[model samples]
Target chain A: MKSVPNRILLLLSLLGFASALTIVFYPLFKKPIHTSVASSMRLKIPRIGIDAAVESVGTSPDGAMDVPQNLDDVAWFNLGPRPGAVGSAVIDGHSGWSHGIPAVFDNLYTIQKGDTILVQDQNGITTTFVVRDVKTYDPKANASAVFTSSDGKTHLNLITCTGPWSAIQKTHVSRLVVFSDMEK
Target chain B: MVIVTMVMTMLASFASPLIASAATTPSLGSAATYGILSSTYTNTTAGTTINGDVGFTTGPALLPGGTHNNYGSGSPYATAGSDQANALSNINNQACTFTFAPGAIDLATDTTHGTIGVYTPGVYCTSGPGAASIGTAGIILSGIGTYIFKIDGALTSVANSAVTLQGASACDVFWAPTQATTLGADSTFVGTNIDASGITLESNVGWKGQALAFGGTVTTVVDDTITVPSCTSQTPIPGGSGTAGTISGGCLWTGPNPCSSYGPQPQKIQIAPVAIAAVPVPVATLPNTGLPPDTKNNTSSVIIISSLSALLLITYIVRGRKIS
Candidate 1:
């Protein structure tokens, strides 16, 4: 009788334990789709950011900003893909600043060929673009191609402060502008 | 209290994976945002066209050097208020041409709804196999101050002739297998593993920007890995975040190139699964309903039986010894 009871108890306990364990570990099995969605939300790669407050406008006939004679306190946009009322979209940023990481334009100083840029509208629609060339010129006799859109194509212009940093007033001697066309 | 706080901290740390999922979803939206150049001055005024011509963004882009060429308004290549002059306009009807024939160019910023053109150190209305086959060139006579020129149309600019910039820099339309939706001097692009064929770069040719492909976005998939950004696997990054983003090769800037970081930009992650330790998941606890708490008798019974079994075995062994 004792053997019988012991045998029954052992069998019952083993079944009960297995059930208990399965219930506890059920979460280990998950939906792959759900996992993928979760993974995407995570930042797998790092990216860059510019100012979100600059006004949006298209290219203008004479929409280019006047280069300050005193390069000392230049005021302009620090992001590309400017959205003005008309003309090619313009976005400007600072190449470097006296303090801090400066602004979005700080990275403009390192641009090279074959780069792509994306500009978005207030509604979150991105306008893709690519790099063609770099230009460095004296502010005195600045050219028009830097700001103008030849072939009347829609493009994005990114401008920033360039040249050696000034110690006294603290500003770049020359301003840099990058012109890019809208990517298809 | 300290123990309780520590426990709580651990629990929260364990649950953070569930908390970081509140960001926005990346999706490739529609592809239909093109701006108008002008009602007139169109090369082939047939269907919509996008011209990617200008390769350089420099001060004094260009000037009209010949007869009736008061294009820069006067001051040569770049003069007072001539910053909008372009290198090439709708010339030769080369659809999608971003170049000019080295001459006087007009910056129609003031001529609202008119054809506007600009210049640069490279070929104006510069054409090539890939660039010329698409988008039409135009000089719309639009009202000035840059009214149109949006980047939504099917337009692009590739290098036909090489352009040189500052002594330390070279310029070319190094067409990567991938193209960007936008371009800029502040941005530079580097093609990884993806062989950039048929595209040549000028000596010391340097640029900064995100690498973009004209064909929407490209992505490849293998047995266990999905590479690049294919139409099915990758979605378009949302727009207007205004965050200076790195599109791997994404940029749209002009001279004195606005972008600063040119060394080695971010690299593409050959996405593959990695083995990781599995952790237990949190579960909901059931409420304990008040009831008569009965002590479990099985354990106690087991203990007693075990003791009895041992005693019986010892007795048997002693009996056997005595018999022998």
Candidate 2:
């Protein structure tokens, strides 16, 4: 009788283990196809009071994304996928507070977690996204993270220069990137 | 004692470099100044049209001056050879030692499969044979930044599998293949430096970037066009990010080169601005900063704690059996 009860207990434990493994690896088992989407035109963030026009900026002849000449506009990398697309859409702006001039992303560093960002496309379709990550890299940091797209989810990464402003380099000492994910 | 050993093992795991997935991209240094640079061998066939200057250092006899009349003779040849030597030294010393950013995608993840479609700027590396290849539709590289394809094994492109760029300058792409690299027939490619052991370009391939065989040799056929990017107006600061440093050379467009008549720049679109709501000051205090949580370290910690719990449970089971 005791052996029978022990056998039943062992069977129950094996079933529990199998169920736990299935729960943990469900995402890997269920492969989902993620399709790439189109370009975005407008960006809205209610939490930080950020509503601005986006300019389609191409790569500078020097290989970096061309910065928006106007401080009021944000430069969107036109070559990459649009915001809410299958890949990561990168947008950059000046965080200039130098020479007494305030730039578009001046308060970008103050963004909080869970903040909502809304992106609108040319076709009048809007996608809602939430702040998922924020990171800072030194001026010499490998910026490849700003461009990688393996997760298959739409990501909008906003970039602005932070840290000490170097007059010699004519840019900041570091770059601040805020990562947001599309609301599923 | 077992508990202590297990704890120490877990601690050492956290301290191991292999546990970290991030690696930084290496800087190219002075090597970025050249179009085609070879250390040991540089030669071209009769029909080969080289738009850029070619150079070689350690040669069995002499590096072959290209069929191009203007660039192959006299002063151009000497200058190109010397430049190639300097660039090769810089590459072997600087670029080879440069740290790589954490490579996210394993180009040979499937080993048998090849990657296609548009990709953003980043470092893609592979460690095995049949690592990375371009398909018939070809692969497009988007963005205007530094992109590195570090292949520890061989790199080959299928026929008609073009490697195109979107808004990026060809000079920004760097292909560092540890083994031989072959461009298939009729494949169009853009990029600056290719630090490889041996590079072979098949017939009828239009290449906008330079091929630098830093280790072995470069073979190019007459029907193939390898135009070194005359980055006259565009400054190519390879490796690092942000502002580019100033570089000096004869960069003015006095005449047309291979890619000069490409086209006008793409137009920029202006979108109307939307109204933004006023930002509110936070009233509550939070311990954690506004950045993403440190999930990597936290996951390790969770694993360690779970293992300890499991060990304790096993110990309890043993004690119970002994009592019974």
Candidate 3:
């Protein structure tokens, strides 16, 4: 009778040991997989009280970078590197919304250097970037540097139309660009 | 005794396969220094600026206009040429995670896109002898992973077509075309072109990568700008370290080669499966922490089970001794 109880205990302990080992090594045997669903990403600027969805935007028919259809959301330049990638990852939002409704980057100009921006990817990994510089450019500025980075460091540049509204151009006369680097 | 033996066997089996694996990036070696490395370099335009080293075995050594280190047919040039060949070979050997159908393959159309095709990092290839072209609509390469486009035939881009990078670096993007590569006029291109044949840059082309031709000439027309991409760190090649043998020279761009020692290596981003068709929805609820809840639970459960097992084993041993 005593041996029977001991046998059950031994069996239970052996089962527990086997399961613990299985759990410890399971991830190693499993293949790591990822799917690129750009919509799964989110952008948050705590300083500006901005937490908005990020939509992948491509080039328009006129060969210019496209923007999000909804003013509340921002458009990620899908044609360039991702937000946390090695090159400059660009995200553009609208400063002015119709009916004076709140927009994603309405207060983008208020963002000062050293501000923190968080980008959450599909896997829920949040990449933090620190604001480095803030610059304003003419509507017709070359703006090539806004999309490309040569220093090989990861960068995130936020763009929103700023300055006085341009009635002739049907857009803002100046553009605001917030340059940020990936926090080490 | 039998149960203990069985548990020990299970533990050994599980622990024996606990080998760790890491992803690795392809080393460019000395060739990483050049914006244009070719057998023969020809320039028809007067105001072309190459932002990196320019090397050729045979050609006019003088560039029409640019502050660049020109390497003539010498040791450095020869080393770069050999390095280019090795890089091309390493690229060719990579297994294609995604393969386009045979025929004239248009990358802009074959890959999924919202307005333009946005490609994640992976080995994208064309089967058989099919030419690949980026249409006038252009294509976007988004993500940090290594992108290797292996074209079995010629590669061409339409005029004004732009290869945009979202968060992808030009340094991590590689293009290996078996035949000649021609960039349309005024088009913006990115990534290193290791073409088996020659590479031709039309007028007013802006290239943010290298043009490395194996044996053919690399020609640039009027007002072409070629800049070598500088990568401080790169996403490792998926699966394992690439077959590309390690070469010595580090990042060579003009400014401090921040990538000289290949800075902090980021986690390898795996290629997404190609079957996803629907447009990515804006924002889904994401986990609040870096680790998902399920993973945390699993980890906790493992720890608990391990503790319990150890305790039970000790108790069993003690009880057995007491009974005896």
Model 1 C-alpha lDDT per residue in residues B1-324, reported as the tens digit of each score: 999999999998776433322111111121101111111111111111111111112111111011111111111111211211111111111132233223222222222222333222121232221222111231221111111121112222222211122221111121222222222122222211111111222222222211222112221111111112112212222221211112232222222111111221223333222332211111111111111112111344445555555555555555556759
Q: Tens digits of per-residue lDDT for model 3 on B143-248? A: 6656789888999998999999988778778888888999999999998898848999999999998888747799988789998876534212222221122233
Query: Which candidate number would show the highest TM-score if scored against the true structure?
Result: 3
Off by over 4 Å in 3: A1-184, B1-24, B111-116, B232-324
Residue B237 displacement (Å), model 1: 37
Chain B vs. true chain B: TM-score for each candidate? 0.16, 0.49, 0.64
Per-model TM values vs. the true structure: 0.24, 0.34, 0.43
> Candidates sorted by TM-score, descending order?
3, 2, 1
**Compared with the true structure, what per-residue lDDT tens digits does model 2 show for residues A1-184?**
2343444544554554555455445535554211111222567788887776666554555556666555566766644555765566777877754223356687899997799988875446788988899998775555666765655567888888777656566556678889988888
List, residue by residue over A1-184, the lDDT tens digit for candidate 1: 3344444545554555554445434435532211110000001001343323232112233434433121121222211223321124444433433211133355565676667665543234555667676676454444445544424356665566566655553444566666666665
lDDT (Cα, 0-100) at B250 in candidate 1: 26
The global C-alpha lDDT for each of the candidates, from Candidate 1 onward, is 0.28, 0.54, 0.68
